[model samples]
Target: MAAAAAELLSDEGYRADGRRPDELRKVRARMGVFAQADGSAYLEQGNTKVLAVVYGPHETRGPRSKALPDRALVNCQCSTAAFSSGERRRRPHGDRPASELALHLKQTFEAAILTHLFPRSQIDIYVQILQADGGNYCACVNAATLAVMDAGIAMRDYVCASTAGLAEDTPLADLSSPEEAAGGPRLVLALLPAAGQIALVQLSARLHQERLETALEAAGRACRALHAVLDRVVRERLREVAALLGD
Candidate 1:
């Protein structure tokens, strides 16, 4: 495979993958793929694969030290399988990167969820990276959207996210790991695309203000594209349920 970061090869403006700066990678998602969890989803964007599970709306368990007085407390844990990448990881969770990602995910979901509606409750979201090609944050957000929808959790809007990488003065959409490592500025934006509201924005490196708007816009557009793919998955799931009921 070509390095997504290398350079803009063609003058016509195409990246290593032949996608235009503003074009997103292909996305596919499925809800309720796991039967045990209250809700589960599998999502794939390009070569990255992720699974998200929502296990509660139930009372808080474990130690009471972290319980909250108002609204449900949202707990998030992110883990990547040792074999999720070409290079294996020794430990799964509690690693510095995983812990930071968990916190970010918790914050992002808290923004989308109607937590006020479920006072004194709890929601646990666990995300596992089945394959870590790149843009893990965006993939997690998209997968979590499906899982939350499967759990019937009330939300203001779908939380969609996508990665943007700056290339030759243009912001390219949906970066893979190679592009990310190429040293260009990259931004991960999680948004309630339907409402045009940003839930989270994280930058991998510094980018100039003059180009920030275009990059943000590109990220938002990629997120909207993600939302459409997720919507289709949800609809297909409902149709499957309807068919089962008929049988």
Candidate 2:
């Protein structure tokens, strides 16, 4: 029994996806994916793909009672496409998991955005998982952060998110679906890389107190790595705009 338990994740220290422990999958992204929205971005992390669109810093909708006096209200709606994962998710909307994830996204951005500047207004963020390889929450947050920045929203810092899973003593970064299914406890983090503040942290299950630090360190390292890629995407987007204006 002890030998089997020790070998649960002992595949020569490599993940099923051929990723070494603490390694992240390829990160690719594009900003301004849609001309209609105030801001939009498409991001792909390995096999997982997500799209994010942002509208406003404009007047609050519906009721005036919903507007905040001191800061802008962040409204977030997150969903998974029925076609994602080569399967159907009938009635993905309004489900408990979807609603909870959307709430988490709302909270994450609210903490990062400088809402006081747009008092009485609202920023609407819509993010959809077009493909779900794993780590859907982190991908949504990463894509939305780009959308918000492309919209020229004021934020204290870039919000980068990543997930970590501990397999025995090994910490795997940027979990893929296979890794997630491996049944190890997982940790997700939304962090402000520049400000050194954590916007959100979630653990799928309890982990050993001693292992928690390593898992956190692995996730935090992945977030910073993602931040670098996101930053480059933003800069390239700016250069493209500048070129268009010059032409």
Candidate 3:
């Protein structure tokens, strides 16, 4: 498999889609896109489509067993649609991967949001993957960021995420599934770009010491790029909101 993937690497160091090693898939995002939710956003990166919704700063309604005294509780459920992938999936939650992803997402948002601001409350963030290309984690984070912002939630910084993979000993940023499947180490990073802090880092496969640094650098650059796109979307959303207010 490694040899097969190695063969897929291009002579010019570009992916099959012609993206340079450090380029991200084109991203499109919108905030307050759903009328039903308190906050919602639809985000697209390449062929991956994800929608995130934030439902509350309301009091916890479930079993009191889950309530926290000093801070808001963050409940996150990450589910993919049945037809989200090339093949159909049977269940939305309770599946092992979905359960794990739910926990990870809960952790990621908890770190970014100021939970203390709304004590004894609950914030529910539900993310549904309408399509799966590559970089699903990054897409979820990016979409959720917009949803949180739309909800007028306070946060310390915008958390942007991106993936990096080592191809032909070169670090490639924002890898597509083909590149990811082409084999080598893959690294996913959730970062606070403005603060230059990493909130999460996950590595798969193996990579050398020197290669990891280069990969981290590439991931950082990809995250910064994602940040710019997100910022533009947020600004556009505020403009629309302002116009509606006629001010």
If scored against the real structure, what TM-score would every candidate get? Answer: 0.94, 0.95, 0.95
lDDT of 3 by residue, 33-129 (tens): 8999999999999989999999998889889877888889999988888888887677866788778777878888888999999988999999998
Score candidate 2 by TM-score against the native: 0.95
Off by over 4 Å in 3: 1-5
lDDT (10s digit) by residue, model 2, range 1-247: 2332243345576656667777889999999999999999999999999999999999999999999999999999988888787656678677777788899999999999999999999999999889999899999999999999999999999999999977666777998886786677889999999877999999988877888988999999999999999999999999999999999
lDDT leaderboard ranking: 2, 3, 1
> Number of backbone collisions per candidate, in order?
0, 0, 0
Error of 3 at 129 (Å): 0.3
Alpha-carbon shift of residue 198 in model 1 (angstroms) = 0.8
lDDT of residue 212 for candidate 3: 89
Q: Model 1 lDDT vs. the true structure?
A: 0.86
- TM-score, cand. 3: 0.95
Tell me the deviation in Å of residue 99 in model 3. Answer: 1.2
| Predicted structure 2: clash tally | 0
Model 2: how far residue 238 lies from native, Å: 0.9
